[model samples]
Target: MIKRVHVLEDDEDIRYIIGVLLKDEGYELQLSSSFSDLKSKLKDSVPDLFILDVMIPDGNGTDICADLKNDIFTKQIPIIVMSADDKNKDKSLGAGADDYISKPFDIDHIVNRINKLLVK
Candidate 1:
């Protein structure tokens, strides 16, 4: 089965790049530019994994990560929190994210992490 991945990134170019790369890897990719958009998508179905950007226009990714972790339904989903500022790594991990990635990230690294997390 194809693994599903939901990504929330405010930057259009970054989102597009990630989408293309993940799609190329044969994972089903869902892209959202805002927290509200991601929430709406979540209502349809939960993805196997989530890739969230730390700072967004409407909400913070760490807060969303914490919320997901707190919810019984979504708590099991692996989450990868990323940021342009490397200092936010601690904040991301503290929020219950499974992994943290620094922005301008290596696509191979992100893809490998996703593969590892979804290997169950």
Candidate 2:
């Protein structure tokens, strides 16, 4: 099965870039610009992995990550939290994110991390 990745990022350019790259890497991609959109998407189907921005227009990624981890339905999904602010690293990890990527993230690194997580 093609692995599905859902990304919650408010930056249009970054969302587009990640979507394109993940698609090219042979994974299915769903992109959401806000927490509301992400929630709506979740109602339809869960993704194999999630990439969330630390600070989004409607919510905080770490909080979302924690919620997902705590939920029975989503707890097994690997989450990768991203932020321009490196200070959010500890918070993201504490929230049960499988990985944290700092922005201006290297695309290869994100891809590699996703691969590693999905392989588990």
Query: Which predicted model would earn the best lDDT?
Result: 2
- Candidate lDDT scores, in order, read 0.93, 0.95
Tens digits of lDDT, candidate 2, 1-120: 899999999999999999999999999988999999998999999999999999998899999999999999999999999999999999999999999999998989988999999993
Best by TM-score: 2
State residue 76's C-alpha deviation in candidate 1, in Å: 0.3
- Over 1-120, each residue of candidate 1 has an lDDT whose tens digit, in order, gives 998999999999999999999999999989999999999998999999999999999999999999999999899999999999998899889999999999789889988988999993
TM-score of every model versus the real structure: 0.97, 0.97
